[model samples]
Target: MPLTRRSLMDAAAARFGWRRAYGDTTTVDELLTEQSEAAYTEAADHAALATAKNTDALAVQPGVLDTRGRILADVLSLEGVLAGARSRSLPSEVVKRLEDVVDHGHEVTVLLAAAAVRAAAAHTSSGN
Candidate 1:
């Protein structure tokens, strides 16, 4: 079965003990949202930098570099998560959830990286 966002959140909640609160008061959406806050912020930053109009190399380079570094770090962190999940013998469903999250992150990062490259190219060609 194809995994839905709810399933992913459920799996994460199960795997991470997010549902362990007294009376199970914490909702899956809240847990997922809390966990995703940093990632969402970084993604938003990447989108803004990618879509920015000003092509000054000096101005844009720092944002591009920062995005690149974050992407690399995310990749490494995902790898570690997968490795740890395997070592811990996590259920296949949970593993799939992790993979799905990583896949989406990769897609966003790739698009953002492409846009940053194009922006950088435009800056270079414009002699900015």
Candidate 2:
């Protein structure tokens, strides 16, 4: 289950003995908010946690591949457009080679994206 702010606050109070006195709870809300913000800030600054989250997010979002692929495809498309606009100056062989490379790059990206999806599925299934 996903962690919630209330759960985090409860855990913090339990783990850190941060509870207030029975009748001195006037600032409890402010104190809890401060504690939660501090905890979140600390967690966010942890490099290993940040990296793990990023890896997991990337694994689950295969569209990341499309984002990069789209950039490459657009660049290639631009090359084609430029070639057409200056067909007299550009060599046909260069354009052909560019197209070939773009096609091969796309095939490779698809394979890698598939592999990433499989790895992410395996990771989730294993409860890691």
Scored by lDDT, the top model is 1
For model 1, how does the per-residue alpha-carbon lDDT over 5-80 read when each residue is reduced to its tens digit?
7567667899977643423545655656765986898989877766775446546656666777798789778978
lDDT of 2 by residue, 1-128 (tens): 12366557668888986752433554566666777988888967765654666666445455556555775677677667656745665677756776676677666667756766776777788787
How far off is residue 94 in model 2, in Å?
0.8
Q: Model 2 segments beyond 4 Å from truth? A: 1-89
| Candidate 2 residue-pair clash tally | 0
Winner by TM-score: 1
Identify the runs in model 1 with alpha carbons over 4 angstroms from their true place. Answer: 1-28, 31-58
lDDT of 1 at 38: 60
* Estimated TM-score for each candidate: 0.53, 0.36
lDDT, candidates in the order shown: 0.73, 0.64
Residue pairs with clashing backbones, model 2: none
